[model samples]
Target: MLDANLKKQLDTYLQNIVSPIELSVSGDNSPKSKELLELATEISGLSGNISLREAAAGRTPSMSVAPAGQAPRVSFAGIPMGHEFTSLVLALLQAGGHPSKASPELQEQIRNLEGQFHFETYISLSCQNCPDVVQALNLMATLNPNISHVMIDGALFQEEVNQRQVMAVPAVYLNGEHFGQGRMSLEEIVGKLDTGAAARKAAALDDKAPYDVLIVGGGPAGAAAAIYAARKGIRTGLVAERFGGQVMDTVGIENFISVPYTEGPKLAASLEQHVKEYGVDIITDQRAAGIRRGELIEVPLASGAALKSKAVILATGARWRELKVPGEAEYRTKGVAYCPHCDGPFFKGKRVAVVGGGNSGIEAAIDLAGIVEHVTVLEFADSLRADEVLQRKANSMGNIDIIMSAQTTEVLGDGSKVVGMQYTDRVSGESKRLEVAGIFVQIGLVPNTEFLQGSEVELTRFGEVVIDNRGATSMAGVFAAGDATTVPYKQIIISMGAGATAALGAFDHLIRAGS
Candidate 1:
């Protein structure tokens, strides 16, 4: 099933395998089964250490990758192609005893887990966030014999998805119970499974010495600031709940300078790698709760640990703006999704509504028109705010309908999932209802400045941190940048520049303070 170029690449990757492994597949005479067998056969043909065998599993058309003649730990219930293809390669390498790049501490944590964990993840091939969760669980399975995992393609196994009422991609189940949905990092997963891990980590963090510059986010802004600060030859540290922030949820990134094209997760990985090269102390899976100003600026984490720094750069970034209407929160992931790129596949052949008229909203409508049966766009303004080209493209699509002066009132659901949406017509003063299985919200973003509400830092009415040209906030010694600040434009390149400015501003403050 793999092309010649793919076979060459696969062969090169398989050379890293140090031990024997088996691809035991369970399939029947069906076309999908044949496809699975063909894929396994092609993979086995590349390396002498790899072998193939026919086996029985609860789910047909499944393939298990494991050590030779041993119980399988990592399995796939459907073809692991598209975004998950990398996951399959990693599974093969890890199963064959190739060393994993996970930190030594994290590997040890996985090996020490006491209880059995059978994880089943349902995902769509088009989802940009599914690979992270799949690879994370697969890593756990490969590390601990007590843990096992299976990645199931939601589109290929519609019956199972319906039975579980899984309306979102990357839905994970632990021991047959709903564990989580959406993008999850390996560290987050381990933290959830190991209850005492957080407290121990917090205690360790509390003992660390003060930093010259501390960055409180891990997006492009935080990464750039960390690199700039570390290069100044002073102590630098960065804390992030997740390294990528909103960028991780982004899809195509064609506008980033120097690089013509890239994806969100790929760019995020590169950013992390670049930051690592600078020897900055990086902390993940920790959310900043609040900041306290003293002789040294202190940032408190939700884990009860406080980090002190001579200068603090706030680049906490932004998140998707919610509808906040009744039933919207309850029906989230039950048919109300924020990311059209990730959740659009699940709404194939169904009607859906896009709740905005800007670039993001119209773009979502255009993208959904290809897969969904019909797309209804509800714009609160009298006219569309999207670019003329986008408006023209959306208008050209036959399956798309645009409504003007629409004010979304409430999301209507059948107590289980979304069945429709209610909106008010500002022009006619009429209430209208549209039957849609899914509601994709693409309104805008809300700055991640809620934690600074009670603090002395000045904020705009919209909660954005007020900053000067040097990226210094209202409070002395505390700088702000990126989407969380009062930057005029919220773009990746702009954030990077803002980050550098903030780092320089912090350095100047430190020099003056020490003098």
Candidate 2:
């Protein structure tokens, strides 16, 4: 199933296996089963330490990886190809007793888990976010014998996907019940299962000494700021709910300068690695609750812990703008999705609607036209705001229909899943309903400044933090940058530049204030 180059690389990775391992194959005479067996055989052939055996499991066309004679803890219910191929490789190494890159504390936390955990994650092959969840669970299963995880391909297992009403990728289930439905770090997953870990960690954070510069986000802007501050020979720290921010949901990023092409997750990983090279104290899985202005600026976390710093840089970034119509939140995962690249595959051969006319919406329509039966683009404006090149490409597609001056009013669902969408004709003042199985909202972004509401910091009417040319905010000793600030552009490169400027501005403030 793998090409020659892929086999060569797998061979190189398999050399890292220090202990004996086994591949337990469960399959039938079906084509998928045969394909799986072929892939398993190819993997087993790479190293002498690896062996294979047929086994009976509840799910067919599955393979389990573990040490010889041990009950396999890491299993794949479907072919782990595409984005999950890396997951397959990692599972092999971890199951073969190779040490993981996870922190020693986190590994111990997994080992101390008390109960048996059977995690099943539904994923699509094209999803960039699914691998993180899958790989994390797989590592947990490897670290703790009581934990077992199975990665299930949603597209290949349509029956289960429909039964679970899984309209989104990276949907996780624990012990046959819903656990989560998005990108989650290993720390976040373990904190959920361990229950008391959050409070303990929060208390530890509360006791930390004040930093010279504290960054309140982990996107590109926050990363750049952390690097700059750390390089300035000062105490730098960064806190974030997630490191990647909105970039994690992004798919193709061809416009980033210096690099010809890259994906969101890859760039986010590089940014994180670069920040780690500095002396910055990186804190994850923590959301900023509010900021308090004082002699030393304070940023409180949602977990009840507050961090203090001489200066603070707010780069909380932004999130996808939602359609605030009725039934939209009720059926968010049921049928309404915000990412076309992540959730588009779930609506194969079904009709879907794109609720915007910008570049993102038109691009989504063009991408979905190949998979879905039909795509209707709804534009509240009279003309599309997409680039002329994109408009031309979308117009050339037969399955795409552009609806001008159509305002989305409501999402229609049958309690279980989406059945259609309701919109209003702005010009004719007529209400219209279109039968679509899914609604992909491609509207612009809203700054993630809700946490800053009621704070002393001045903000624009749109909730963006008002900033000067030096990136300093109205609040003394506090600066802002990136999407959270009133920046004219929201591109990645622009965010990075703003981050550097904010860091420098904070440093200047610290020097002048006699910090």
Candidate 3:
């Protein structure tokens, strides 16, 4: 566990000096330098940015990706608490924005392997801007054999730019293809790698023959598909950008039927374990670029690996559609939180808010009532959309209060932490502020099917993978299930059942194809 004083001191450091551009600011350390940023730089990778280290040591610190670029310049490991996390990588990404020649390894691989090495580092010359971006990219290129970069001047890159037909400084062109123009955010770049990786994989797989079963998502659905099919005597393989799917973010998953109170991480871990136990080959951190036609399915991986399978099951689950309010993304751990189960324990006896009015929201508020000192539920609807049971439970909680027709207007906080929130009453257009330690978003979930870029798998109007009674999809030898599928319920029990059903269907398809 991070010492309380240390965490607080780190919080102070984050608010005053941390910015994605800090790129952890200067690998060179000089004690004579009297700047918070320099101090930040010195201590940024203190733990070697190793989340695994803390976990192995039995201390809980939730860390996601560093602020920028492909690899770890500062290795923003551990739960990215504040601006320090951002500073760690921004410097590296800033370095990416140059004609700065790289080592032979970078020059040979990333410069042309996938196509072109195009990148735009968004920054001003300030220490807060360009330095981190450049350094982060340098670090990232070390891991990926095929990635190189060039920088664009912040002042000149902004001049009368022709984003189209290519006359731009801060933009990258990949084999004459424009990657992006204007200021590139971290999320934007992450999305870019996703497609870029997928594109390369799809192209490579275009030549392969299909297999018995090809699972599109590497989440609960795909993992289950691989396990069940392998168990039932069928050849199967799973592809996804990241293994364990969003379930990895889930600290614990108690609602997942059969298992009444399991950590989400534990559940996902066990699922991955079970799949491997059945001899199901699980590809971690790979995406399905595309699925080509054949007697079976020819699925491509973002890593340029091609896989073939007879039937494909899209177990791609759902992701939380963010509020997109300002501080929501910026100050995530610094007071802005998502999962009640994950971050709730940290705020014991503190005030918090839950967004939305449906059963999910009401249930969350009701659950939070017991833990936090105060619980405020902001609902966009006139009345709660929760079922009677949840509504009754929420109404019964003294600490929980509901505000109808309320919508989040702005997430206001110190640059490094969230201290309050602003909302507008739908009826009167009146705005108000609420002070809370965290806000839970129970608004909705989005199915993960972006990989179906060119496939025939049908999706519902709501973006779910369409499936028949047995969890079969519109395409022959393909199956669908879990939240991503057209299954009405997104409950865990239903997802498991659907996963089983699809596995069975894939097994049947395999048997018939073999016979």
The model with the greater lDDT, 2 or 3, is 2
Give me candidate 1's TM-score against the actual structure.
0.98
lDDT, model 3, position 341: 48
TM-score of 2: 0.98
Q: Write the per-residue lDDT of candidate 3 for residues 313-427, one digit (tens) a residue.
A: 8787988877888678776645665556444544558888898888777877876787789999999889888899888888887898889999898787766556779999999
Per-model TM-score versus the true fold: 0.98, 0.98, 0.56
Lowest lDDT block of 10, candidate 1: 506-515
What clash pairs does model 1 have?
Answer: none
Off by over 4 Å in 3: 1-210, 241-243, 248-260, 294-296, 345-350, 366-373, 387-398, 511-515
lDDT of 2 by residue, 1-515 (tens): 99999999999999999999999999999999999999999999989999999999988889999998798999999899988999999999988878998899999999999998999999988899999999999999998989999999988889999999999988999999999998999999999999999999999999999999999999999999999889999999999999978888888898999899999999999999999999689999999999997768899999999999999999999998999999999999899998887798999999999999999999999999998999999999999999999999999999999999999999999998999999999999999999999999999999999998898899999999999999999889999999999999899999999999999999999999988
Error of 2 at 338 (Å): 0.8
Q: What is the lDDT of residue 411 in candidate 3?
A: 80
Clashes of 1: 0
Error of 3 at 28 (Å): 34
- Worst lDDT 10-window in candidate 2: 243-252
Over 1-515, each residue of candidate 1 has an lDDT whose tens digit, in order, gives 99999999999999999999999999999999999999999999999999999999999889999989789999999999988999999999999999999999999999999999999999988788999999999999999999999999888888998899899988999999999999999999999999999999999999999999999999999999999999999999999999988889888888898899999899999999999999999999999999998778899999999999999999999999999999999999999999888889889999999999999999999999999999999999999999999999999999999999999999999988999999999999999999999999999999998889899889999999999999999899999899998898989989999999999999999999882
Q: How far is candidate 1 from the true structure (C-alpha RMSD, Å)?
A: 1.1
